[model samples]
Target: MITVDTVCALIAKKLGSKATDLTLGADTAFDSVGLSSLQIADIVYTIEDDAEVELDPSQAANVKTVGDLVELVETTRAAGAAA
Candidate 1:
């Protein structure tokens, strides 16, 4: 059920004041929003924790956009449920 908005909210929460003026969307690149690698990792960790699913580190590393992170979360959640 993870969506782009969910990820965007997480990013915004992490960014705080930095996100006030940024327009977050599915296709928006992480770099475009001025996200650092550490920030991304923290967001991913939060997602994994919230979803109660551990995502593949390799796949997580490849996520570049909000949509990508959402998809990864959904996919990982689905796989965990299926198992």
Candidate 2:
């Protein structure tokens, strides 16, 4: 039940920016917006908890945007449900 808007809001809150400041596009780079490793980890964990989906830590490290995080969680949830 996690929506893209919710994810974007989470990202904005985590980054300490207004949601309007982010484009929430697939190509937006996290580092470009000042997201550090610790912040990214915190956001990822929050998403994991909110979505109730476990993500691979290795793969999570490679996520670069709001869309990437959404895709990762959706895909991981799909794969888990399939299994």
Candidate 3:
């Protein structure tokens, strides 16, 4: 299972910020890190690289926060395995 802590750590590494800036809770917004749209795309790419999973653009579009992203990744991974 992909834990929120692991997701936060990855986001921290990708954004070059401390994990302390992030929260595992649903209220934590990705934009709260002060990353731009381009940065967010790069973050998605980085997640794909590290997690070894390709994210659908549609699903990626739905991610607005760390928790939203974690859920997307988990669901997409499960669907990928089921296919």
Winner by TM-score: 1
Cα lDDT tens digits, model 2, 1-83, are: 56667766666787664555667655667777677788878878988998899999898988877778888999999999999
- Candidate 1 at 80: error in angstroms? 1.6
Rank all candidate structures by their TM-score, best first, as comma-separated numbers.
Answer: 1, 2, 3
Query: Which segments of candidate 1 are over 4 A away from where they belong?
Result: none
Clashes of each: 0, 0, 0
Leading candidate by lDDT: 1
Q: Give the local distance difference test score of model 2.
A: 0.78
Task: State the displacement of the C-alpha of residue 61, model 1, in Å, after optimal TM-score superposition.
Answer: 0.3
Question: How high is the lDDT of residue 60 in model 3?
Answer: 97
TM-score of structure candidate 2 = 0.80
Model 2 Cα displacement at 62 (Å)?
Answer: 1.3
Give the Å shift of residue 5 in candidate 1: 1.5
Clashing pairs in 3: none
lDDT of each: 0.89, 0.78, 0.75
What are the candidates' C-alpha RMSDs?
A: 1.1, 2.1, 2.5
Query: On residues 1-83, what C-alpha lDDT tens digit does candidate 1 reach at each position?
Result: 67788889998998899899999999988878888899889999998888788999999999999899889988888888899
Model 1 / residue 49 / CA error / Å: 0.6
